[model samples]
Target: MSDSSPLPPVRLHPEAELARDALSTPLLSRAARLARWAGPDTRVDAGGGLVDEQLPAAAELLGLTGDAAAAHAAEAWRVAVDTGLVEVTDEEAGTVAAGEDLPLLTGGSPHDILAVWLAALEAVLADATVPDLDDLAEAMDESGEIDFSRLDWDPESEAAFLDGVLGNLYLLTVTEDGPGDGPVPLPALAASMIVPGDLGEPTNDMLEQISDAMMRLDDQFRLLEPIGLVAYQPVDEALMGDPEEEPAAPLDETDVSRYGMVRLTPLGLYGLRARLLEAGFGAPAVGDLVDKGADALLDGSSGYGPLAARAETQQWLDRREPLAAARELLAAARGSDEGAPLRRLRCQQALSLVGAQAEPAVRDVLDDPELGGLARVWLSELGAADVPPPSADLVYWLTIDTLAAQLAAEGNSEELQTLLEGLAQQHSGFFAAAWRVGHPATADVLEAMGRLHPDKRIAKEARKAAFKARSQQGG
Candidate 1:
């Protein structure tokens, strides 16, 4: 995802609810338990990890039993120390205590709890980038420091690769056309990073690269899941028999899950958005424009998808009286700027959500040159009584405005092409009079119609009309 463009607005659960989820995540919950369980008896190494001798005891305390139990206990202890839930009191003696942030988990506001969770998320993300301890041990040099070159790892690139993967997952979760809550196949997610957009077929090398990345992500997501970042279904253990083998292709539709599937949890959405904002990305949320003015609402949501725009408009309308909101929207919709047409289009959409109470406001704008057509359409749709018919001039002006708005919003989409064809079929003399419409977008709309019309003769007429309109304006 480009940091330059704003991400699709996310619909986050309330902070209090998210905080509850954060408090329940396996890693954070284990860390919090260890924080409460810690005392003068709890010993740590120089790095603040639980001493090896105490790992079994810690694991038992957490009711964890198995070959990997000690490792899990050690991971939780590290998170406790990293997040300040368990602070080392004496470096030399290795004494520890419940840190300053521990009590805040039980007593403080939702924001405070989430703040600690974000810190823990950062720690987990950092850990996910490192090679396994066994690998590091094997790469240890004579002086005892692990040789990163031997490990074939670049710290910066590893972190960036993980960040990029999570960023893509976040994009997928929030985008309208993406699978919002559905699990994305792990191979597909990995391929998004490895494969270029324009690549038609994956080369043997690229497929191998994607396979390697998938294994890396499998490990990473396993670490991330305990912290509530993702709900991951690990690649089937049966598929991991030989690392040298080419990635297995799913035999059937049901077999795809064998490769793995993953989705961001709701808590993950909140965490990623916060991180994106801190990193200087414009990550908007659905209710962000609720308290802003109508102009801001229309302008801010002009680039939003249909669902997000409606959601934002509804939230903005929920706080104001219908009539006043309608009036404000109509007032904001009247502009000669290049963005005015879409803003008015968005305004019309917003007004549709208003009820009969806004009928007066709609009627008030019936004589407005810029907004009259919109007002008439709204009133006519609402089945309001005694609405006057629009003149030929007003109809032509409205047509230009509507087409301009569609052009701005969808950019010569198939739907616009269909609309253009229908309009030309309905009115034989459209291009002749469309060139004379007083709307600022008249020439541009005519030019778009010329480009979009399927019929060659009508297209030529549209081009001629556009030229005439531009010449008249230039004068």
Candidate 2:
């Protein structure tokens, strides 16, 4: 995802709801439990982790029982310390207490609870970058220090790779054409980072790199799941046993899940969006324009997909009376700027959601030079009584405006090509009069029609009309 362009707006759950989810995540819940369990008796090591002797008690307190229970408890304790859910009061004494953020989990607002969760997410993400326990053990030297060369890890690069993977996952979840809330295959996700866009076929080296990346992602996603960042299906153990083994049969779509599948949880979306915005990415959310004016709503959502735009418009409309909202939209749609046609198109869509209560507002604009044609269409669509017929000039102006909006929204699209062909076929004299329409987009629309029309004769006529229109405008 490019940081330059805004991301598709995510529809986040309410903060209070997300806070409840945050409090419910295993990692944060465990950390919170350990925080409340700590008191004067709780002792910590120099690193602020629970001392080994106290790990059993801490694990028991959290009802964890397994060979790895102590390790889990220790992991939660580290998160608590790092996120200030527990604080080391005296470093030399190695004493600990419930930190300042602990109370926020219970008594503070939903925002406060989410703030602590975000901190925990950060800590966990940092840990995910580190090699697993066995890898660390191998990297350790006789002097008990980690040999950086043996580790073969660059901290900055590892963090960046993970960030890129999560960013792509977030993009997939929020984009209209992407698999929103669906589990993406792990191989495909890894390939998104490894494969060049223009590459036709993957070589052995590229496939091997993707396989390695998948294994790393499997481990990272496992760590992330406990913190509620992803719902992961780990790579099948059978697939990992031997890198050179051949399958009995070719893999099919039905068996793809064995490779692995992952989806971002709703809570995860909220967390990642917050992180993206903090990193200076233009990550927008659906209800962001609810409090803004109609002009802002139309302008802001001009780039949104159909479903998202409708959702945003509905939220904006929910706040005001129908008649007033309709009037405001029409007023905002009457601009001569470059973006005006698309804005007007968005306005028409927004007004469609309004009820008959807005009929007066639509009727009131029937005489407006810029908006009259649009108002007539709306009224006619609603079967409003006594709608007046539009003049030839009004019809031609509306045609240019509509075509301009379509071109802006879907540049050189096949559907627009079909529309241009049908219009030319229906009206033999269209170009002759279209060049005279007073709309700002008249010449541009004619030129687009000329370029897109497949018939040479019609294309020539359109080009001629475009030249006439441009000359008439003294441009």
Prediction-by-prediction clash tally: 0, 0
For model 2, residues 1-475, the per-residue Cα lDDT tens digits are: 7789999999999999999999999999999999999999889988898899999999999999989999999999999999999999999989988898899999999999999999999999999999888989999899999887998799999999999999999999999989998999999999989999899998899999999999999999999999999999999777765548876655554688999999999999999999999999999999999999999999999889899999999999999989899999999999888899999999999989996878899899899998899999988989888999999898998899999999988899999999999999999999989998877788899899889999999999999999999999889
| TM-scores, all models, native as reference | 0.96, 0.95
lDDT of each: 0.93, 0.93
Candidate 1 lDDT tens digits, 1-475: 7779999899999999999999999999999999999999988889898899999989998999989999999999999999999999999999999999999999989999999999999999999999988899999999999787899888899999999999999999999999999999999999999999999999999999999999999999999999998999999886886657655564343688989999999999999999999999999999999999999999999888899999999999999989899999999999998999999999999999996878898889899999899989988999989998998899988888988889998898999999999999999888878898888888899889889888999999999999999998994
Candidate 1 lDDT score relative to the true structure: 0.93
Shift of residue 77 alpha carbon in model 1, Å: 1.0
